[model samples]
Target: MRLVLLSLLLVLAGCQAPASNQASQPKVPTFYNHWELFAIDAVKVPRLKPAQRLDVDRNYMVSGMAGCNRVFGQGKFEAGVLTFENLSTTMKICPAELDRYEQSITEVLSNDPKVTMYRGDLVLRANHRVLQYRLVKETSSQ
Candidate 1:
């Protein structure tokens, strides 16, 4: 009886071992895709009527909306760091609040920002500002 009980316990222990080992590997976050800015500097930004979004492809080309203007540029992401260059926006007037918001976003994008992932959201920190974006899912027109 004792031998059987010991063998049973060992088998159960072996089964649980793999479960713990599988969870030991942590998930690494990747940002080579599209995301939407949901908050700036910790303040929630309401979704725009026509939708504002940011796209960063595998080639690191940056294109998106900044307030009421269209923004396009080149970006680099390596070693967990991100930076944008030559960012240009369309010459369009916007509401005072949106213009201010655009300034804050462009300011960060123009400089190098520390990037991290929190609760599945991509976060960028720079110039005493924090930009939090949520991943945008791709939809097919079909």
Candidate 2:
């Protein structure tokens, strides 16, 4: 009886793959909270009002911005590399600093994803765990 029970347990365990063995999202190199500023780009700066579900689509990982209209830009996330083409924001009137904050958001869209002051860097997972993006803007001088 002991031998039969041991064999059955072993078979059950084998049938169920180990947690570590389960296929999971790809891992990135590392994460950083803040990124250095660089020249802003004219072409890539996304429109003021982003009317899209930025996070749902595996297309990109994004978050930030308040209401739909008069939206204040927050942050964005991307896997591998980031792009300014995709941004979701509400259109809400904001103060000067918030407006400028939105501009900065556009600038960093290429440098690195919006970072948490305390969190440092955001973790980009295929699912809910927000993704990271790297923005590369083209200077207007060109």
Candidate 3:
């Protein structure tokens, strides 16, 4: 009887054991949300009157305002890298500085960027450029 109890206890313990494949488990993408560009290459992004944000959905679709133009595209995220395909942007003429910023942003997005989450910030690295974005929390006003 004692041996049976010991065997039963061992079975229960085995059942409760944490999964051994935890490390190999697929990483859940936490970058799916509204994000605002905070910095580029360690420098603060130029202030823009309009909304400067990027929205990434679970389907990997991306859309946002990059400084002066509105950008939309289908994105593919895999193995910690994000790449956009056929990215299209509005051709609205913008101020020289904002236009420059927009160009830089598009360039970064065009290149497959390595993505990492650091201290709650989404960091993208591509072509020696680091683009940092902060999550924009949505608030419900009743």
Candidate 4:
């Protein structure tokens, strides 16, 4: 009788679920997916002539176009935290105002930002800014 009870208790323990928080943690989206900037700080993003966008790959590489310049760097996403490193951009000159916007984007990307999804939009929050991006559907050519 004692052996049976011990075995039952061990099986019960093994069957128990994990902690609530652990079970409830949001699943990280596939970071390798492509996305396009949609808005910043709740403001509609200005249309860029060259189309600013971001693309991340499984190899920890990030590439994007920032208004007027091509940008690429190393980036990592873990546990909902996104971080960029060693980002470099082309020196091409854009409009003064657009250049400022580009700088802001680079600054945010280089920081340790918290990433979340809202209403099918990928939102990145850092400091006092919130950037929202929409998933970019893959083209058949790619």
C-alpha RMSD values across all candidates: 5.6, 13.3, 3.2, 3.6
lDDT per residue, candidate 3, 10-118, as tens digits?
9988876656567668875578788888898999975577757888877779899987799999989889999886888998999987877787788888898888888
lDDT of 2 by residue, 33-142 (tens): 22222212322223334321122223234444422322222333445544445454556676664465454443444344433222432323221223333322222332
Q: By summed lDDT, which 10 consecutive residues of candidate 3 come out lowest?
A: 133-142
* Model 1 alpha-carbon drift over 4 Å, by segment: 1-28, 138-142
Work out the TM-score per prediction.
Answer: 0.72, 0.31, 0.82, 0.75
- Using TM-score as the measure, which candidate wins? 3
* Highest-scoring model, lDDT: 3
lDDT of 4 by residue, 1-142 (tens): 9999999999877776566657897787665667788888888887776777888777658788876888889877788888766778888988986786687677677677788888877787887788788888653433
- Which regions of candidate 3 are displaced past 4 Å? 1-10, 13-18, 24-26, 138-142
Question: What global local distance difference test value does model 2 have?
Answer: 0.39
Report the C-alpha lDDT of model 1 over 93-134, residue by residue, as the tens digit.
Answer: 988877877887788887787878998788888889888889
Question: On a 0 to 1 TM-score scale, where does candidate 1 land against the true structure?
Answer: 0.72
CA lDDT scores, all candidates in order:
0.80, 0.39, 0.82, 0.77
Worst 10 residues of 4 by lDDT: 133-142
lDDT of 2 at 101: 41
| Candidate 4 or 1, higher lDDT | 1
